[model samples]
Target chain A: MLSLLRPGSNPRRELEAAAIALLLSIAIGSLLMLAAGVSPGRVWFAMIERTAGDPYLLGQVLYKATGLALCGLAVALALDAGLFNIGVEGQLSAGVLACAVTGASLPESTPGILAIPLCLAAAAAAGAVVGASIGALRAMRGAHEVITSIMLNAIVAGVSLWIGNEVLFQGGTTRGNTIVEGAQLPLLPMSGSSVNAALVLALVVVAIVWFLRVRTTWGRTWIAVGQEPAAARAVGISVARVQTLVMAGSGALAGLAAANFVMGHKHAFEEGLGRGTGFLGISVALLGRSHPVGVLLAAVLLGLLSSGGLAVGDLVPKELMEMLQGVVVLSVAAAGPWVARRSVTVVPEVAA
Target chain B: MTTARLMRVASLALAACVLLCAGALFYGGSAYALERWITGGVALAVVGVACVVAGAFGSTAMRIAAVIVAAAAIAGAVLETATHSELFVAVASTAFGAQALKIAIPYALAAMGGAVTERAGVIDLALEAKLLFGAFTAAAVGYASGNVYVGVAGGVLAGMAVAALQLGLALRLTADQVIVGVALNLLALGGTRFLLQLIFHEGANSPPSPAFENTVLSNPIFWLAVAAAVLVPLAMLHTRWGLRLRAAGDRPEALVAVGASPSRARFAAGLVGGALAGAGGAQLSLSVGGFSADMSSGRGYIALAMVILSGWRPAWAAIACLGVGGAEALEIQLQVTGSGVPRELAPLLPYVLTLIVIIIAGGKGSAAPRSLGRVS
Candidate 1:
């Protein structure tokens, strides 16, 4: 158990570190709930019960998890290439718009099989374009992708406002027209819940990503580039090309995540459809350690927390859950290094 | 020294003027029919291009001439606009300037904070968190104490605490600064929103706190912000402590060679930087009279851009803040005036401009701290 807690290159230590960080975050979260005059125990218990007991809430959690997992994968992909694409939020916005526009433009007679796929493809392409712009800026102009991505988020926000207001806005409303029936993803057989094919799609994407990450030549090169760009360049790998392509792929994942909303849940584009999903993806990726399995699990856990937070609104502010998410990410980052250092020293002492 | 380089710049300027003149001519038929000011602006822009071309020959006279012509072109545009609309002049001078100053304050403070921390080789992306937490603390304290000053102090301390978290996580534990910063920001947002709702039973905004009246001289926070902008640069450039911090950023091994601790210097710099950012946050909440959810509203990010634009110079960063503030002020003015430009597009000006500036100026030879964002 102690060896598990020791931070090392081994996956077991990483998992232990993550678990410890999560526990600490929960402790901090409980204290915060108590300060707010809510019984942390009651709130947490209710949160779990509501999410686990109710089929509808469970569906909602899965719905949220679908989008978050894809976004986590998106960020993880970029990180794999040594690129920080914080513009996942912006890319999601672009995808939403793309799906909305494509959905709106397509004929109502078009079959759902064709239309839904087209919308998803459009969204992914649009997001890839946006992500590629940031990558190109980083590669060609030497602009730091971090700051550029942040700026792009703001710009995308403005652009979305314009699109919602001027282009796609329904009469006298802040929302766009609902997509054609054929464009909507079919709901699953789950009773009274909006769980759709998107969840299955998310899992499929996760599997494909895991395969690509662990098996492909490009994947190996991407990992090599991330670890040591100069060494990769010395070995004749075009780092710039890898950065651009990985970032684009990352953006495509985020765009696909938008399908969980625009296609699965909302059936239309709205002003805040993918609100906070992009940033939440960052937290999910951190918590999951960017592994496909880890990201899937982290996404589901966060989705549960969000559902739970909303459920306990009468006792504790739902925002507390978000704070806990943030705390988990921070504590995990902090704890991993602390445990790693300790393990290093302890190992040296043992050898002596 | 190379004619080819000079010619390239000259040709670019010439192309720019030609495009501007053509645009003016094409659009001149409606509002600018026979408007000599439009013609004059175009003419002066042409003259500026000519002077730029001449200046490539390495003559100071030609360079000064180019600057004068460029200034005249700007004056011409202003003259045309001012002549066309009296409200534009009035708004541009008083309301716009005042609004710009208010917007600039927090940006300048945050940028100064960034400058200091970055100079000590730490990238504190948690300025957004610091500002948010500080604003919340100030609002809560100010509401409770009914004294804006005490509230401000509370805000500063809160900011310091947040900064200490960054220092510990990023420096002590050697975590990714960006991740830590992002986490801090999310935490601040969530924590403040939770607390606000819990305490006030409202999720949107804090109850109105003691606020400074709009009296220019009487508002202590405004003056304090200004003092910080001035003093921070002086402290950064002049003090022995400042020198150590600089070395820690650029040459930590050298500082260690001299028996000084780079980590301590960095820690101290982070604290001071956080304090300044906190002061800025105080200005934001105190001026508005309360904390609003997500009130920092990406200003911290803009301040980061301003730091890059200013090339790590504190004073210049403050000045850049004013320029960004002007863009924000213009965004508000466009909304109010119902300008011909799309309202949605108007709010995008500052962000788009930041991207442009960063793209153009962020390349090789830019003055980022040598070891900025490096792990010690």
Candidate 2:
């Protein structure tokens, strides 16, 4: 135990320990569930079957995945830029509100083509403003983006609540205004779930972001800034400018996610619509290692956990899935440094 | 040198008078606002004087003055704000005081726990998890045993278990502490909810605990808390363990050179922190007689803010917690009187005020601990 606590322990051993720890956490959770009279095997089977076996349920998972993917991509971008953009929750809320309000105000006779684009634009603009506020605060006043973003999220929640209650409340109800039909995103062909064109849009955005980050000069600048802001500055890069641009882009993606959720699925902004997605996005980014491909994979896994857990509620408590997800995130984070250290050791051994 | 000290004191005095006068003028523009304006002005004046005195003399005397001034200001402000001719006072007195106390005490305790842990060189961001675990275990065992004390003990034990688990990974496995902390919070939330649903056939909200009938407040516990608030700082500064802890935080290598184990110090600190936070959670359910899904209600986060505002000093944290608690109490009071302020704004007041405090403190660069957030 003392040796385990020492600083100079081998990285390979640490990774193995982390894997064991994760397995132990799962086993303990399962035992607790069993003690509560739940059949752990049945629960596990139900969760998997609900996610992959049924078409309708699978569609729900996909619908959730699309939103998570967009938000995950946003987080990935921000992480790559070394910005912890926790304000995605607020940005998403604002986007949903903007989409709903804009759609409600538009003429019923308006074409779906025009209305959809207009709503998307509105969401993007709102998100951009929020994202830029964080960037500007960081650049000009040295306020930490994490703190400002969190404060902004609270402010947004308050403002959204006020709007839902006071202004855009449909027919004097506390709920949000009903979105216009013309503004709703059209569903994909024969999908039982409300999977819409937004998935395609999200995919396009992901590709664009990936291309920019890996292929463009600006992307290289962002990577440079992320790695070492001081060194980037020494190399004549404008760190502040890059940070602002990356953050704005990140907010835009989150806003788009909100727009997709409201226009394609809910057709109305609900209180708590963000549903802890902002924080979950942090987990997704970390789990994905800030890579686009990794983000997509992580987002899908998270989506499966959420939708599958809900679908299998009769067999397993949904909270079990949440616990598992949290454990996975923790294990991954714990494993990161050890993995880095192990690679170092392996390279030296191979050279020898 | 004494002249220089006196000059510094006089300048600080002048600054305080100026700020108070300015605050009075700013808020006293309307006759209806005069009382609140004056109260706020005086409080600011007291704080300003305390700051200057601390700068001129030493932290020890400054801390004593802070406690006295804090108490006096709270009592005076509560009295004036509660009974002033303004209609807001009556509502504020009745409604805001109880509710805010209900919320603030738990947070203050959690923050004090954090203060202890951070001061001892361990990074503890799992306060929310600890709180949730305490609440969950207390509710479950309390319902089972039909004894609130047993529930409280169970909660503390649960918290210690979590601390031990986190320490195992953080200290032994060299896992990232923050990540583990966040995971622990999530696990507590999800695990508790799962158990609640499975066993009680209810959602996350458990049945109320067998409440302590308000006798605990009358018992020695309340006084003990107060005394602990006062003495912990002195103990921390003067005791050998305290010295080791501070050394570990400031310079872990130095502590190691002096034959102390940093990991051991951190483990002890983490356990103590967990226990304190657990007690705070126990106070919530066992004292209040009920449990809800979000019983902790972001107090864990508020405790984090308090740790920052208090600058890692336990006594200062207590003072900051009191101020926050007072503000919360005032907000509740205003709400009850049906003051002109919107109901939404009432709940938002503390958060907004804290944000402002953060901004101002951030401007001065004196709010947070210098060594905070670093691995070493």
DockQ of 2: 0.22
Q: Evaluate model 2: give its lDDT.
A: 0.67
Model 2 per-residue lDDT at B141 = 87
In candidate 2, stretches whose alpha carbon ends up further than 4 angstroms from where it belongs are A1-35, A128-152, A172-174, A233-245, A346-352, B1-87, B91-102, B219-221, B363-371
- Per-candidate TM-score against the hidden true structure: 0.88, 0.81
Q: Against the true two-chain complex, what DockQ does each candidate achieve? A: 0.39, 0.22
lDDT of 2 at A216: 88
Indicate the docking level reached by candidate 1: acceptable
Flag clash pairs in model 2.
B91-B333, B91-B336, B91-B337, B92-B333, B92-B334, B96-B332, B96-B333
Which stretches in model 1 have alpha-carbon errors above 4 Å?
A1-9, A345-352, B1-83, B91-95, B215-217, B363-366
lDDT tens readout by residue for model 1, A1-352: 0111111147876787678778888899889988988788998898898778888888888888898999988988887777777899999999999998899889879898899899999999989988987886676545678778988898888878877887788898888888888988888766667778899999999999888878888778888777778999999998877888888899999999878898887888898887888988987887787778888999999888887788787787777887787888788777777766766644433210
Fnat of the models, one by one? 0.69, 0.32
Per-residue C-alpha lDDT of model 1 across residues B1-376, encoded as one tens digit per residue? 5643543464445435533643453344456545654565575556556445543543333433443344345334534544555436655587668877887888888888888888898887899988999899999999999999999998889888999989988878788787788789889888888889888988889999999887545777668778877887788778988999899888887888888988899989999889878888988898889999989877777788677656677777777787777767766765675544467766676676566455434432336677777763
